[model samples]
Target: MSAFSRFTPLVSVLPSTVPFVGPEAIERQRGLKVEARIGANENGFGPAPSVLAAMREQAGDIWKYNDPENFDLREALAAHLGVTAANIAIGGGIDELLGQIVRMVIEPKMPVVTSLGGYPTFNFHVAGFGGRLVTVPYVNDREDLSGLLDAVKRESAPLVYFANPDNPMGSWWDADRIVAFARALPETCLLVLDEAYSETGPAGSLPPIEALIGLPNVVRTRTFSKAYGLAGARVGYAISTPGTALAFDKIRNHFGMNRLATAAALAALKDQAYLAEVVGNIHAARERIASIARANQLSPLPSATNFVAIDAGRDGTHARSIVDGLMQHGVFIRMPGVAPLNRCVRVSVGPERDMARFEEALPEVLRLLD
Candidate 1:
């Protein structure tokens, strides 16, 4: 195939491949359907009825572009979060915002720090911006905050990514410890404290808004995709000092937000009752997944997120086989990508129907493996 040859050296050097192989792609490649659909860490309980109604009502307004400044959504998010409007930077999702942050600070070959098996999307963004990744391995299935800080200092890294109630492992440190870790880092390093699973975490697991509110170096990325059930809507934001928040405006897509998605987000925020209801459902589903893991004679790692990581009593190969076998029964799920952590498969909480599919299929998968 012939192609244009005017691309930058960095762009030409990089592989034009996506990091995630979504279930849709899996189904196409393997000729299998994803019946359970409990993968991707998405809230399978679905969005609120009120949100659906709002989207339906606003469907006619799709002809208009969303406010370039995102005025209404910003005001509502600020009001809900008890922060000034100037402190927030809205984006398509945490993923896009991660790219913007990387673009802001990372020049070619600059070092960025994160857990070895942390969120791959952030690392993808870092690589896109020509940043060198310096990873600290997980300590007992959790991102090591102290180790991350050490790497930042030792490498004089300018950017670090930390996910609360982290992905893949679904582990978290308490608010105080997280705050201490943030404070210990040098002011030169900016911490992207990702709280994509904050709503699913236990009380006190997340730091208060006031804890790191004043730190210019700390930008916390949050998503409505978790407990809010709005992953398809692609609503996410970051909170930081006004100056730091304004940095996003320089490079972010000014009119990229979808019209109906904004209406859905506004409606979702107005319905705290519904959010509380979904959060309860999430907790129950988490317990159900853990119970299923236990009944299969596997160890279910405690998690503050909407997913549970089960120890398969073996290695990554065993974990991978269990994951593949589950998919044979239309149970789509995922596991970590590295050793030690990859010894476990991750399952997201979903409605009873999905849970039932997993519960029925898990034993058969394990029995086959055994």
Candidate 2:
């Protein structure tokens, strides 16, 4: 039997791939249950009691489709940030929103700028849309704002993507520096400021909502998937000018928002006390991770996000060994995918028991490598 042959040329030309090989797939492939799930940057701390309650109550209503407009969640987010509801657009997650943003602006062969080793999901979206990605290498383990700006100008790129409290390396820039970089970009360029790790970052690290709220060219994407402990809920939002946000409606799935996920997010927002408590726990877990790395004689990079990127003192192969070796013991962790950055393995902050498992597994994994 042969497959249908009427697919678009771009679709036909693209190779099939999964950017992330999830733990579930690993379990299926290796026949090993994931005893400690501390790899996916998921909040191992779990969601708030309030969010759980809300989801449970809404479970009965799952038979109905979610509101196409996502009015309630957007209003709740607006009140939380003191922005108007029109400025918000909801999506399945940052990953889904990324595709929408690319579709809204990218044409085949148009330029899109990003850090070389930045989030891969964004790059995947660019590829799907046939956008030419112009990448700038990270400098000293941080995304080079100057280099990104240069590429944007050089490529005359219509869109650029950046993440604060970045993934893979868990490095970040202070708000003032980030604001300066955003302000310097040309008004014609659209900036996708991914702040998925915002809840775990320090106070001065995030600029005030009002800081970039006025810029028509800037759209900040945030997720409840981080400190809110809601990754499975698939809830995220974009903050932009009302005009800029309306563009999402043009290409978004009218019923994409899950009713329960919106309910979970609304309840999550109301539980600020829970958020503050989780942030504290995240900080403590980060310290615990750092201490464990020190005891193992490896260096753990400081992280504002929910994960630590530990320098394994070697190249990508060595880092891959540590990663694969951990999975052997049912401890699933990840590492950066590119060179230089791949020298570090990223372990997400999790419950004390999971961390204890990681602590127990590290020495044996390194010993086996020796």
Candidate 3:
């Protein structure tokens, strides 16, 4: 019954936690089936038929390992983004790349800067590496760029994480401001510009590849999980100077990528028309979610991602009650974690069936709360 005593100190002291409790875990813990899974910011509209077909075709090759170089995916992404293949590094997803970045730059007790309530998975990676997190609170529901830069300077932090079309709040700054923020950071600091929701964001919200590609300290991460509807496939990549991008190869899992996932991502990239159509559907669903919130007398904040955050007009407890109540009726959703932000509930865009289930369940949940 005795536990192994040889675990690292950091691992022993860290609390066992997940960035988000998945819907499957919720269903198991609460003994309820999820009728509508609009909580995880997944593209419930699903992947393009072409992507599915490609995956099916490649499934027969599952016994083979994916190319360690990730040649085809990186080359495809480079051509799509107008960059050289040497400027790219592929990973299982943004989450894995974040962990690698943290390990590359952080030593024990070193400072890492990020928004107070930004993507929790980045925070989790920082903690796993024993880095001290220096958080800057959101200003007006958006990640405070000036505040984050100030903290980075004040702490002389070597690593910083920022997300465009940020999670939890679903807020973003235009490309110009993001570029300025990146330029302002000291050359000693490495910036992790997380653009996982890039395809869903508005025009001019993403900086062009030419803007920061030459900066050695800047690494922009993107994923197939959102607009591409490939969350299950676990494909993502980082864009940086060729020198900086190569750093991931020194520490990354050489054969971590799945073969079929690579095929799906390649097919998804080739089908720009499908991406556009899904984006249009996503826009409509955002409006539908906002309308549902307004009909229930709650306010929906403007969102640049696949999800919308609705202000429940009270404290964390009240927002939590609505989240819980909705789940009781088989509609699964989530809420922000920290104070002030926690007054809102976050819902992801899905198909009309999921939206209809949410529309029917929300008013009943709120009525019960009333």
Candidate 4:
């Protein structure tokens, strides 16, 4: 039973770990069914009816491989965002594209800058590619732009990752500040501006496409997972200069996109009315989540994403207890992976029924903790 030993040094040294332990895995491990699935910032409101209809109509086309160029989706996204199709690169999701970006820029032991305790998946990708991660701590619950830029300069790091409407804490930076940060980075460094929560974010929170489009070093990633409720579809895209965007084609899995997912995205893009409607619901659900957190005596942070991170008024262990305690009652939620941030449990905005379940379960869980 000896193992074959020809794996690359990087692969050999990496630990076997998943970035996120999904709710399904939790269910299997703990033997409990999730009644309110709001842990991962998924849109429990679900995809628009038009998107669903488009997918169903194209389901019969499953036998065909998706266009490697992703022509139609790119065209649709370009028109939607007021950019040329050449400005876009499609991927299964932001996660996959992060890997591709890391591969394109990182070499063994090269420094990559990111916010400490920010979007673990990007960190995961950096580690997978053998890059040295230079982290800057959050300042006042937002990613420290100045610190990240300093780290990039100090380390001569070729790449950096920053998520606006960031995960775990659900905090954001205004567009002006983000553009300033991008403009300030050294031309030698590339910035991965993750905007997965763009649709849910407030106006003026996202920089207009033209603001940074001229910069070859900045890539903004957006997703259908949060606001469009297409997590299962794994459709996301990156926006950058045509030259920078074309780098994805060099290492990307051609024909890797799902045909139906492309159809879904095309439909989703065309259904702006439905998107606006879902965004309204997302706003309402954010308030609902905050209200519930306040009712339970926890302070909820202001959020522009589909989730809120509530300060549990204790240490990581106490916040963890709330997370575990909720799961025991069939309410699944998540918490930040590191301290200071981990003092809060993150809750995603779900439909009213899921919200009701969480509302009923939270007090019981807190009472148990007390």
Candidate 5:
């Protein structure tokens, strides 16, 4: 295939790929339908009725661009988090915010630190910007704070990402430990403390807004996509010192936000009761997933987030077979990409119907594999 001749050296050298394959793409490529959409860590309980109503109410205003500054959302988030408006930066989602963060601090070949099998999207952004990745392996299925710190110091890395209630494994460290790790870091090394699963994590898993808010080197990212059930809305925010928060305004696409999505997020925030209810449902579904895994002789790891990672009690190849087998039954699921962590298959919490699909399919898949 022919392509444009005038491209940057980096762009020409980089392979064209996304971090993860979407289920739609899987369906298209494999001629299979995803009946149980429990692969992506999406809140299958869905947004509240009030959120839908708000989006419908805003439908007439879709023709107009969203407020470029995102003033209202930031103010609302600030009030909710007990911070000033200047301390918040709103973006399409945490993914976009991660890219912007990498672009801001990482020059060509600059070292960035993260867990070995951490969030791949962040690694995708780092690679896109020509940043070198310095990885620290997981300790006992959780991100290694000490290992990450050591790598950062040894490499003199400029940026480090640590996701609480982490993805893939759903493990987490306590708030105090996380805060201590943040304080121990060199002020020159910025920390992207990703709390995307904050709403769904255990009580003590997330540090208070006041704990790291004063640190210019710390940027904590959160999203309405999990317990709030607004993954499609693409609403996420970053909390930091006023000076650090303002940097996002320099590079972020000001009008990229969808008007209805913003309306959905605003309404989701207002409905605290609905958020609590959905979180309960998530917890219950997590238990149900664990039960299903255990009944089939698989071990389900304890999760602080909305998904459970079931150890297939074998190597990565065995876990891959389980993931592929489940998909054959119209159940879509995912697993970690590297060794040891990849020994488990990840299943997201969903409504009862989706859960039933997973339950009915898992045992049969395991039986066939046996």
Candidate 6:
């Protein structure tokens, strides 16, 4: 009737939680089918035909263990990014890679810097490793670069997590500013530049890969989950100096790469034309979301990511009402977990029908809330 008593002290004290409450869990809890799945930032447009075909081809290989080194995928990613394979480290996705990064760098009580209300999963990893989280609040709905720098310097932190085309709020900074922020950090602190939304960001938003690839302290994490429409594939990679990347080999799950998922990613990378088409669709959906928000008299923040965060013209409580109200109508959406940011509802881009469902639900939700 009781749990094992021999677990580590850190594990014993950690609260059991998932950083994001997914739509499936909501469906189970509320007994409502999600008719419009515009939450969790998933690309509802789905993956390319080439990607699905590649996965189907690899289906028979499920009986075999994936290549432990993930060589072909690494090589493919390296070639795609114009970096050598040595500079890349593949993991299930950015989420897994984040845990590996925290494990590699954070020790008990070590300080980890991040923007407050930034990526909560990274903070969850930091907590699991017993690292102290040093947070800087967002300034004007964007990550505070200068404040984050100050926190790192003040705490002499070993790691900092920043996202470009950031989540929840979907704001981004120009590449020059990010490069400058990365360069300004002390060599002792490692920067986790999360670029999960990189493919969807506007021009001038992402730095050239070369800008920080040479920095041993800089590791850029990206995923196939966003614009590539491969969230379920769980394929992601980290780019850093060859020396910096080898650290992952020390603690990562060597055979964690799924064979079919790797096949999907490889095919996705090869089909650049499909990626371009998806990005265009994402742009159009963002505009549609903005228009819907405007119609409801809510202010939509300019987004460079696949989602739009609309200011609901009230506080977190009101925003929660909107989120809950939409779910009641079988339309799922999300909002930020922290103050100020929570005043906005975050909606992911999807296909026309999904957008139409959201467009129809917004006014009704707002009307009920009003």
Q: Candidate 2 regions off by >4 Å?
A: none
**What C-alpha lDDT values do all the predictions have?**
0.93, 0.94, 0.94, 0.94, 0.94, 0.95
Clashes of 6: 0
Screening candidate 1 with a backbone cut-off below 3 angstroms (N, C-alpha, C), the clashing residue pairs are none
Q: Name the better of 4 and 6 by lDDT.
A: 6
Estimate the TM-score for candidate 2. Answer: 0.99
**Candidate 4 lDDT score at position 187:** 96
The TM-score measured for candidate 3 stands at: 0.99
Alpha carbon deviation, residue 9, candidate 4 (Å): 1.1
Error of 2 at 350 (Å): 0.7
- Clash count of each predicted structure: 0, 0, 0, 1, 0, 0
Candidate 4 worst ten-residue window by lDDT: 1-10
> If scored against the real structure, what TM-score would every candidate get?
0.99, 0.99, 0.99, 0.99, 0.99, 0.99
**Comparing 2 and 5 by lDDT, which wins?**
5
Q: Per-residue CA lDDT of candidate 1, range 20-121, in tens?
A: 889999999889999998879999988999999999988999999999898998999999989999999999989989999999999999999999988888
Cα lDDT over the full model 3: 0.94
Write candidate 4's Cα lDDT for 273-299 as tens digits. 999999999999999999999999999
lDDT of 5 by residue, 1-370 (tens): 9999989998899999999999999999999999999999998999999999999888999999999988888889988999999999998889999999999999989999999999999999999999999999998999999999999999999999999989989999999999999999999999999999998888899999999998999999999888898988899999999999999989999989998998898899999999999999999999999999999999999998999999999999999999999999999999999988999999999999999999999989998888
Q: Which parts of model 3 are misplaced by more than 4 Å? A: none
Look at candidate 6 and give me any clashing residue pairs.
none
